[model samples]
Target: MARSYSSYIVAQSKRTPCLQNVCQFISDDCRKHDCKIVSLEFFAQDEKPRRTDLDQLNLEALLNTDVCGCQGRLIIVEDLSTAVIETLGSCLDIDPLFFASQIHGPTFDIVSSKPSDAILPSRALSQNFLSVQYQRTVDFGACSSAPRKMLRNSNVPRKIVLLPPIKNRSIGLEQQSCSILLSTTKSKPWLGLILVDKPNSDKYTTSEKQLVLPSTPFQGGYEDFSERPCFFEPDSGSPGRVSLLEDLVYYWEKERPPAFQPDQPTLLSLTYYPLKIAAAEWVSYVAVISHSIKQFEYSTEATFEEHGLRKIDSDLRSLEVWGRRCLQTSSKLQSAISFLKYQINGAPELEEYSLMIRDFEYIADLVTTYGRRLEIMVPVVTSVLQITDTRRSLKEAANVTRLTYLALLFVPLSFVASLFSMNGGVSAHDLTIYFAVALPLCAMVFFVTRLPTFDFVPLGPAFGKFGNWMRKAL
Candidate 1:
């Protein structure tokens, strides 16, 4: 056979007589419906009069109660006393679900009706008959006509009654339509209410606040509810202002990992905003340096032939200036890194900036290394070009001088030969003697022709091999 189940509603009141009357009413209703009354418990502090101490009560009254062989229903009624509300407001840690039922109980199935002329009796009687319970009188003149009925009909307790609206202001209404309402009372420390406004379908629209009571406790620190200090606000002197060095010290003290020691090189990262600015500056400096070096290379290539030595000397000076400037910029970058490191010591997000600075430092070192090589190569190449130019000029001069001397010696010889040939030879022996003399002169001419024209070797073949190798390698 299927077993019958009973529902248990847990409630609390300001006094025991009120609690007993409510329990008796619920029990009578359950008996009329052929359902059994499982159990009912009241939660209240011991210091108050007519209060039941749930902590000292018998556990079996609540634990052994059966409801359809399932977990018995738990209905909690909380009296929102003034003390309870004040205690809840001051506490940061409290469960929000325990007070949800009482705040939302009256609105479970309220029906709309016109304002009535009849007055409700302010008194009631209970089975125990020890005390007469009087309903708390509420002044509806302070409330709007629409919500006044809902408030008057709700008989939960005097302490939990919703207060009437303050004059000149709409009570329980939020400025923003989408905003939620939060409620706190001393009796239930952890509960909060989320009130929403739902659109009405009726032509006669009335402003109604729908309360959303959370069924669970809110889990977070009290600081979560505290407001952060505004940027423009003056400091409250809680702690002194943070300086760059102080910031670094604080991070080094607080956030530095246990494995990290003061002796080890600390890596500081940069925030995106500062890092981007620094990167832009570094890139601009690099571009300027590159342009200056390119100008030097251009000057070197242009005046190499005409102003060979002088142009190279000028280029050397310019390169040195560029190197000095690069060094200066590098120093500035180092200083920036140091400053930013101090600022970003404890900041985890800005760590990348430190890496970027390190990379820029490496680039600066590379530039310095290359600058040294350029210094050496500039003078060497200039000397080689000068020596090559001098050798070419001397070779041309030697060729011209050799041709002039040869012409001077041959011109007279040619004239004498011509004079001797023009005259009739007196005898064969005389002609033979003249021929022998001419033969010796011709032999000397041949010997002079065999002599090298210039002392320096021709540059064409030697330089051609070098040029060809360079082309292939490049």
Candidate 2:
């Protein structure tokens, strides 16, 4: 008997009512069909999702994921709301499935949200710094009979910086979207490298209109290469597709060395910006973290230690996720470069590749440095926290000692006063009453110490008014 099909209900996830258009039966419904797969992308220009659905839509799909190996779910948001962060935390709280569960708990990782407070470099990336060889043929050959100085800048440090956004930045190269080439024989798509961005009026220059050509399939017109560029639409639905867009990139993969195993199907929107802009964002992310690390490393006061450590840990995780993503992204861009070389003869694609590689190198080093720094600092920070706890324990012990002495002073009086109430040799009965009074009194004293409220601070009235206003406002 043929299996019956469920109505196309655009089923909502049990996690949230606001979550809609979930592809519930795609895999089963198309099992026997000609293997048609449709993947969708919500670009950076699209409107943000409603606040309520934020948790269930992206997060719910991301948790039960199998993407590139040794990574966690990454959600890049324009606005970092408490709800979103909380949702992300819950999604990562625990991987319940036997296959998905790797790290005991909390797998979802968010790399960045909002504009970074990075100590941004003054110059645009294009003008940041080019390698310049300063050389002079000196007659010092006469002074030493041979060149005394064979100084080569082998270990010269390049400034890793987040550049300020450029205005009227010449329309970055016009590129084509990815496409698949069809064959009459066996069925399998030839994955193509796609264009990541297009020239926009605000960012790209007017010259782009003429320089940029519409994407077209190869027709043996290889001589006039400027008219076409190779671009492939990334298929998010299949894990076997080596080149992946941000939306399809997996958070957690169990495989080692991350081989191409496109067996899983994923559906969700990801934060996708132009490649250049994404690189810029990642750089700023690193710079801001580096700055924050510097602040903690140099500060003389202990005041920043507590909150600072939390921030440090959070940023560290972000770096680790960002690093893996960059590594994967860089590998994929190589194909793009090769395609550019073929499509646009004598294009400066190699230079662009170098720039990306340089940034990638910096990103890798930053992650390594941060990881080592954190490994060292974690122990030291833990010791400091332990010391704090010891100090607090000692203070509490001292207070307890004082209370014990005061209780001793009343012991004889309380006993003698209770003697009168006891019918001769009914002292045990009176003792039970004594415990009732003493137990309550001790409990009150112990718990009162924990309360932040003090007699001198009249904060109740003001706090009450604030609470009332907040309730009305909400």
Candidate 3:
């Protein structure tokens, strides 16, 4: 017995008339070719079926007459060509070259030439269609061969070639889309291959333009290319494409040389790597350089006290000269000291390394002036104390001299008064006057002996302890 096979064309459509007409045309064509006409299933608008689960349904049996013995083939004919394209593109298992040959007209030649890997179901093809069934598996080899033959015949100004994505282990082609966009809209018509993985899954959509470089002939090899992954957003526009040539140029300019140049062997191997990787390494190198500069600045700032002191001392000399001029007047000396104190206590600006050095120099100047003055002032203070002691001694000596002079003047007077009182005439009254004068003279002697001598002491341990205690209290 001869084996019987069946073919089924599964399609979805909103427009009933167009769906019915297309189904009838396909059924008539199958019969003319000596194939048995199974059943024509018209899924009306009310019978809108979901396409997602269409593969699992008894679509083959519903359209085929002899189910058990039939070898089945499914050909989807839809009014929405774009939607049909997109739906088929998303089904990874479905080979698009098998059905793309059914599209009518010269456009079929160009469409057929496109790599089967590039075929993507378009959103427009999802709207409306019909389904047909037959008893044999569809042969797509003839359809696959037509695309390459078409490319050979056409002298189109721009050519778009789509190649599969690179795989780590396999040499076989991966799914991809390629199209050429003409720079001059009039020169060569734009060609597009829309690829869809799923309604919402990853879709590969791309556009390319041809360029003629001054150094190269137009007939040479196609160099300029751009590609992008496309997705449908509810209201958003299409996806953008990145040019491979442009990407290469950008990475080439951005990449930096290694800090330490490697040996020739390593350098030659590095040249084979992608420019993006090289650029990343260059960025990392620059970051390290910047960090090192900061570290050096910090180290220098930390050692500013040692290296920066000389500059500070020079400024200090000027401050000391000013201090000396002001010191002659006590009030100005106090004002100068207050200013120096204020400067030391206030915060300094050291944001930049150079600024920190400048500030250190300023500080050095102030310290130099203050340091020198402190040294000179300490000895001067000692000398002044000695002079004060000498002055106190001289004052005490003068007081004693005065007391001696007073004693000389009053003793004779007192004696004379007593002598007078001793005389026989008016003796009682004279004695009373002599006693009053003698009493005042003794009081004066007592006061002169006690007052000035109280504070005089030798500079020894006791005096040193007393001085320290005084300082602490102050």
TM-score ranking from best candidate downward: 1, 2, 3
> What's the residue-level lDDT of 203 in candidate 3?
21
Residue 173 displacement in candidate 2 (angstroms)? 27
In Å, residue 115's CA in model 2 sits off its true spot by 30
C-alpha local distance difference test of each model: 0.33, 0.30, 0.28
* Model 1: how far residue 433 lies from native, Å: 12
lDDT measured at residue 1 in model 2 versus the true structure, 0 to 100: 56
Candidate 1 worst ten-residue window by lDDT: 125-134
Tell me the number of clashing residue pairs for each predicted model.
12, 16, 42
Give the TM-scores of the predictions, in the order they appear: 0.29, 0.28, 0.18
List the candidate 1 regions with Cα displacement exceeding 4 Å: 1-275, 287-314, 342-349, 352-356, 404-443, 446-474
Tens-place lDDT per residue, model 3, 49-113, is: 11211221333333223333222212222122332333333432232233332322222243223
**Which lDDT tens digits does candidate 1 get at residues 149-238?**
222111121111222233322122111011111222233222212111111111121236532211110011001111355899873322
Best by lDDT: 1
